[model samples]
Target chain A: MILHGYFRSSAAWRVRIALGLKGLTARQVSRHLRKGEQAAPDHLALNPQGLVPTLEVAGQGALTQSLAVLEWLDETQPGPRLLPADAWGRARVRALAQIIACDIHPIQNLRVLQYLKREMGQEQPAIDAWARHWIATGLAAFEARLAEPAAGRFCHGDVPGMADLCLVPQLGNARRFGCDLSPYPRILAVEAACRALPAFMAAAPEAQPDAE
Target chain B: MILHGYFRSSAAWRVRIALGLKGLTARQVSRHLRKGEQAAPDHLALNPQGLVPTLEVAGQGALTQSLAVLEWLDETQPGPRLLPADAWGRARVRALAQIIACDIHPIQNLRVLQYLKREMGQEQPAIDAWARHWIATGLAAFEARLAEPAAGRFCHGDVPGMADLCLVPQLGNARRFGCDLSPYPRILAVEAACRALPAFMAAAPEAQPDAE
Candidate 1:
């Protein structure tokens, strides 16, 4: 299998961590999202979404969406389970993941930022503010969720699970946008815990082949 | 199971249809979002995110996030799978749902609209324009995905699956924002097909007890 990805993309970074957690390796295929490489005919053919982190599984075919790709990796590979065994615990973990994946990350992605600048003709200050605004708002809710007793060293339990895979990448994006992280103390603590793991550190965007 | 929801929330509506499709009935608890009911202390205790459609199962406490709740409903209730069995097919279907659930919905949610009014002091007209802009961009990509031959009458092969559940609620939202639907012929067609289904029709906001 080959993983087509860009270093800066949180979505791609997510899949990388999941693969590492499972002790599985895939050949890396760098796609420069910043340079419009994703929109090229070849890449578009693989993923009509024109997004990075499309997994080219040898016989199974390609998988898109970081959460989906991660779920696939967890189910297909044997290692530390990314999710809890019980249904209720699984629901909590998935809900935590979606809080970041669905609620926080999407609104502040690069594409939306570009649209704000180009299509809406918003100035840089406005765009930056826009990014921070959504991040701050979403993170506030994330922090509240983590305040629960269910949150241990990580978002859910002691060991890093599915939610950790998502939180790290999104926090990276948050820092890149210079959003204030002070409001989310629990989130910061969780990020620190996740980063200590070799798998998460190995999957860092800076550790990727496409890192600038 | 019991569902804490509002009549007009798309996220809540998605869970409503999922529950109906799975052949389970949950006691419907209404939280009128526009009236700040979701923000009340009682509601926040159930869902820290202050989002509607937090599912309270007879045995399973409270499950927040529509996607998570839907998955739990699938696992517990027998008949009619919400997701595909195979990993690759599952990934494809999930990515389609995220395209709307993550990419489209968050930016146009009620909280974001309130932020535009209170934070940036943007006028109603500009705020409405912002909502329309994000929805059109997302729906365009949604339409592109639907054009793939894998798509049948619905988002995937014929039956209204998870993606279709997401799509229908979002289309209801898009229409509420008064978006121009002409550009998205395929999306409209799929939604039309979805509306024809009894499950989708029964889950409409206006069909709910608290819809006023």
Candidate 2:
């Protein structure tokens, strides 16, 4: 397996954690997002969206989209399953994950920030504020969800599952953008529990091969 | 089943199509997004994010997030399955869906546009441009993905699956924003195919009880 990714991409970080949890190693192919290497014709051919963490499985072709790739890994590989066993539990975990992946991360990603700066002519402070706002809002909701009975040591249960996978990377981005974390104790606790595992520890952006 | 949703919400529209495809009907509980009804205390208790469509199943509690709800409906209900049977094919379909749901739609949703206009002090034309930009960019990638051998009359095969559920709604938004659709012939063709289905037609926002 070959994983085409950038060091600091939260989406790629999610995939890395899944691989570690699955005890599977993929050859790393770094795409320097800042240098726009992901948009290179070859990479674009692999993923039409030209995003990172495109997993080239042995024979299954390339899987793009972090959640899709993560779910695919969970389905095909034998390891700690990322989702719950039942339908309702799966829905809960997926909703938690998508709250970050869909509602939060997409609005504050690098490209959107760049658009705000370049196209909208927003200053750095405004851009940072925009990022922080979405992160804080989303995390508050996540924290509330975690306060529910379904949440255990992790986002779903005693085991770190899909929601934890998403929460850890998002908190990474939140910390990077200097967002206040005081309000989200549940999310912070889940992050701490997830980081205690080798999978989450190994997948941190600073631990990646391409990290500056 | 009762669905708390805004008529024009692309995410909610996806679930409506899935419900129709599954031959299930839900009582319509409209949340006027522009009026901030989704953020009401009662709705927030049901969905922490205060977004729609939140499906209130008979025994399962309120399910949030469109993709999560769509998948849950697919899992628990009897219908023409929205996902492909194979893991690889499922991954492909999901990746296509997320390319819109995760990458495109969230960034251009009503809240984000409101942020751009009110907080950022951008004008309507600029906000419209931002919407068109993300839609066009995402649709171009979607079109390319459809060009792959795995793609048939629909995003995966001849069946109108999850990807098509996402595509048709997004194209509707694109057209509403006055985005030029000429570049994505494959996407348009797929939209036409999907709209041909009674499920998709019935799920159209205009057909909803709260469309006004």
The list of candidate 2 runs beyond 4 A from truth reads none
Worst 10 residues of 1 chain A by lDDT: A113-122
Look at candidate 1 and tell me the lDDT of residue A149.
80
- The collision pairs in model 2 are none
DockQ of 1: 0.66
Per-model i-RMS in Å?
A: 1.7, 0.5
Chain B TM-score, structure 2: 0.98
DockQ of each: 0.66, 0.92
Q: Write the per-residue lDDT of candidate 2 for residues B1-212, one digit (tens) a residue.
A: 99999889999999999999999999989999999999999999999999998999887699999999988988989979999999999999999999999999999999999999989999999999999999988999999999999899889989998999999999989999999999998988888899899999999999999988
Q: What tens digits encode model 1's per-residue C-alpha lDDT throughout A1-212?
A: 89999889898888889888889898998889778888888887778778887999887667777888887788778999999888888889999899888888887888877866775567788777888877787788788989888889998889889998988998998898899899889999999998888999999989988788
Error of 2 at B144 (Å): 0.1
lDDT of 2 by residue, A63-90 (tens): 9999999889999899889999999999
Best-matching candidate per DockQ: 2
